[model samples]
Target: MRLTMLTFGLFAGPAFAQPGPPAEGPDEIVVTGQKRDGTLQDADASITVLDAEAIDQARLRDFRQLDDLVPNVQFNEAGQLSNVFITIRGVESNPFIVNRAAVYIDGIPFRELTNAVLSQVESIEVLRGPQGTLYGANSESGLIVIRTRAPSRDAEGEVRVTGSLFSGTGGAGIEAYYSTPLVSDTLAASLAVKYGREATWMRNRAAGVTEPGEIEERFVHGRLRWTPSDRTTLNATAYLLDINAPGLFDNDFFPQDRTLYDQLYGALNGGRPSGRYGYFHDAPKRTDETEYVLGLSVAHEVGSGTVDAAVSYRRDRSDSLGLDFDFTSLPTAAGRDDNDQRVTNAELRYASAQQQPLSFLAGVAYFRDDKDNQKSTFVGPGDLDSYVAAPVQTRSIESLSGFGSLRWRPAFVRDVTLSAGLRYDHTRQRAVQREGQLDLGGGSILYYTDARLASTDDAWLPRFSITWEPTDDATFFGTIARGYIPGGFNLAATQENITDPDVLRYRSETMWSYEIGFRVRSADGRFRASGAVFQIDSNNWQEIRVLTDETGRPVSSDFIGSSASIRSRGFEVEASWRAVPGFDLSASFGYADATYLYLFNGIEDLAGNRVKLVPEYDANLSARYQHRSGVFARAAMNFVGAMALDERSYAVQPATTMIDLQLGYENERFTARLFVDNLTNVRRFSGLGFDNLAFGTDGTVYGALEAPRIVGAEVEMRF
Candidate 1:
């Protein structure tokens, strides 16, 4: 039994590490996705785990860094603090619909993926496939769980400083973490803080601005834990984050036709083409954002199980000034946005002892969110006076869910286990949008919309799995799961000459996923590997659509449910090997075939088109070598395949490769490191958007390019 557990741990997840000296063999990895502590194999799911050592080695300061390390997953960053999307297994997430997969930070749910600071962390777990049976709605694609380091009985602290240069831009940052015992044997507290500033890499040629994308950020996190008795425990946590970026949304625009590049450049510039990071926007641009979170949790031991309860509150606010809708120096149009959001979440659960043949977990959860949004379009000269259209809206969402899971191990067949889970969720939403008015100096046009709108949706998600371990070195599993995303009223729903109810409210989206997987480890523990293949069938997939008038001119846009059926099939494999005493190698590869089985929009038929924003394949390879004298070196290469940028497949991003290298020396008290990311200086674009609608040019397209080659150094000291 001991050997069986050791083999399972080695093949369960990607990696794990302890705090002190390195172990001779792989460390055991425990996961909490089932609301209880258990091995990754026990969870009956495909998951990726990264511990503190891996994170530190990778220099993972933000979510975007995960794109190169994780297979079949991509983190799309729009060059702003609040603009981020996570795509998993071809289930893409866009700016408008941001929560394809749910994210949890220390048990606090964040439906919208924000670019939060990742510092002083413990472990990160990425779970692929639908997790609605345990996490509820907004987790149709998958889930990401972040567990922060907790306070310890002994006093400990660390301080770090880093400096970096990327794409002609320079940046510096500082971070500190401290944890100590508050009382002799009952209470402990921890605190973490971070500050960073970066000079803009972009130059606004038209505005004569040298650095248009300057950014600054500050973050703080604190927590307290109390163990009143052997059977009772409590925890309280609070965090605050603030960011300010000027001209962060200033994207570069170019012509679709290669031959027209010179013509477009001559028109924007004075007969000279723009640089790689140069744009022609003249409007004033600014973005400021702030967020705060508070959380509390309690646990108590019962007769044969443990009861847990947790609650959290979060508030987020942002204000943005300009995007240069026309993508030119001419002040044809600019935009302004003000948004505020508040969220509250609570959950209670009980888990039976894991040693029993029959173990179970049950939970009930509640969630509420309120949003106030205002958007305005400024037109005419200087984009300072006169309005094209302005609208203000308020929305409220509430949800209630109950979920349960059971795992049974038969006495007759100790090697086989069966697991099942189910969850029922009900959601309600209410919204009110004021009529928008457009004043272009000639006359005033009114865009009328329903003053009050409401929607209600319910879903029942279920999952089933079977696991068999015939030998101590090998394991096999199969699973089937259901995923769901609730429907909601469109923020821009209008009543003027529109009669179809479907246009105002979209239907829910659902999918069924089937998977089979295997895990294996060598008897000597020098090698471990895992592989899985899956198929997903989806119905009523929601898509963003533009509303056109009688003249075929675009007016407004909204999320609409598509009648088309979609399918995604994929396979992923990962392996790690210790070649020698101080050398290790790892590699991963993934391939996905996602397409529209059948589709008929109002204007065109995209029956066989590939799904937008999903890559065809991705691969990664890395090697690390360490010396007994506390010296180490690592190198990694990542590849991403081509992907369609739009449903019509009119535009696409070509495949690209990136390489990173790191060298460091570490000891008990001090450490220093040097690293280079994107060593080849490859050009990577997150999105390519066509601009032919209102306040746009006919043959122009815009995109946000990722930062170029970055070179940095860091130093850390521990006390």
Candidate 2:
């Protein structure tokens, strides 16, 4: 039989149902998306939602599976999964997120802003553009929300095991859901646990490569619900996550030709091996992070409206282990002393009656975050050759913000709602780097206190959105918003300066966006459709530039209107169809035009500058099907357009295509699935080149490789 894409009708989908109205499931109302508890379709901002079912369907284990799912969201992770290159809507691509994005798990925020691996995520929501009011932190571009499933109230449990060929490794997971009645009329409790591990797909014929490096993660979620009387409920939920990922960076090739290596000898340069057959064989580098979160929420009915309050707290700690940095770079065997984060938030909301044609929600929030980060360096004896005590850097950051929004329904229009929001933020940030003069015997003598300087910043953001319903089955909306990112000290800018220091303090950035979208579904609810168009005007954006100032410590330079402008315009479209009984299909595609609008300096870049690794056009299209007969099969594919690597729009990474196929079967108690990612073994660079120019030494941080094509299968049975 010929396979076809899921076809759709003309009607838009349904409006998001508010709580108490009861529509859809828990997965639709993720806190990280809108923080308003609504479906992505009803949300005021642009968002991408990836649910566990969809995650499993795609045979996803890591962020590779997340690529292109969201129009401009790409993994910015480097050397290890501990760093985050997360930018939203090209807001902070070659620059930095500073304020472009903020990450959250449940209602608690992850204070550390790095390209870290996501662990225990039941669903990942990417909110495009600035989200300063609803989410705190540096949410200038938007936000990335990760929601982990909580323990269920009703008792249920399962265990799954899968073995795949290639790495000779097996994967296993056991999950338990238990609920116990407490105090009969007052309380009930629930708990859950999950764990899994797999082997690496890449084979290194080079020296030093070994075993046990496949990605592995474990998750725990638990909660308690208490009801003292009707119309009132109290809930407390807590969760823990532990994740370990081996070295993440891949080297594509060297800049100069390999034949030069033969003539130059190892002396011509570091004379590293041929980049052609690069491999990782030495001790594997690792990033281990653990996060814990707990939240308490209370809901009470007040007349026609409802009053709800929630308080949440979370702590995340990360540690880097082993002899690793990036490939071809110095072996960085180091650790940090203060790699910890803490966040606390409290919110009160008044929601109007949903049954009434006109209803609105007004909320106010207060949040506080404290973080301590310290960097340590240790040089290795083998290939590194030269050795010295690595410098130590410490950072402390804090922020506070407030937000408000109002929604109104017009008397003339029964299905349309209009909303507006405004938010104010104040933050205090400080960084200190003290160079140490420890002797070989280990007696420490502090060298430079002037090497450390501190600074502070403040800002405000505004947003507006409108939702219109031509009919009960169709909805349309438009949004306009302003976003920003905070500035900080650049470590590289310092070392580059010996007598003079690189200037300190990088300022904040702001970007404005306008968007219109539509969601439609057929009368039978069998077919669904949604689409959107957007244009973003970026102001005072940030990017790296070689400066002559000795104190020019790579700082966040504020553009007082010299035209560091950028324009990002794009379209998002999707369709979901049930088509036939017991058979389901879905497909989505997007088009984008991302580019710098103005030339910062009349001096055209000769190296052919491209801002960062944002592609002009990128898309993802997938199709999956399951038969009512309890038999299922699936096939999917991904497409990527060429991306620019520099600011002058000069260097470019050629684009490529990939295809994946999946097959699965499910019975009363068992299920099996076979999946292939990049089935054709297409290898691509996950992102562009980046470097710490302050070294006073040139470290060619270029051509970082990404995930190779992977083909694997999974099988599971529940009892």
TM-scores for the candidates: 0.92, 0.79
After superposition, candidate 1 runs with Cα above 4 Å error: 1-26, 208-211, 250-262, 383-389, 438-448, 548-555, 692-697
Put down candidate 2 lDDT per residue, 409-528, tens digits, no spaces. Answer: 778776678777777777776666666542211122224343656666676677888887776567788888877766666644454453332234555667788888887777666777
Model-by-model lDDT, in order? 0.74, 0.55
Error of 2 at 705 (Å): 3.7
**Best-performing candidate as measured by lDDT:** 1
Q: For candidate 1, write residues 1-719 as lDDT tens digits.
A: 00000000010111111233333455456676556667654457777777778787777766777767778888765554446678888887776664788888777777876765466667778888999988998899899887777777789999988888876767888888898999977998888787888765555667554347777877777878788887877888787877787765423333344335446545655565666666666566777788888888888889898888888898988877665655566655566667899999998888888788899999999999999987666665553343344666898889999999999999999799899999999999898977766432212243656478898999999999999988666789999999988877765556354557787787888999898988877867778788889999989887766555554334554545557678999999888898999898889898889898876767888988988788899999999888989998999999999987667776777898999899999888988989998899876667534553334344544556666788999899999
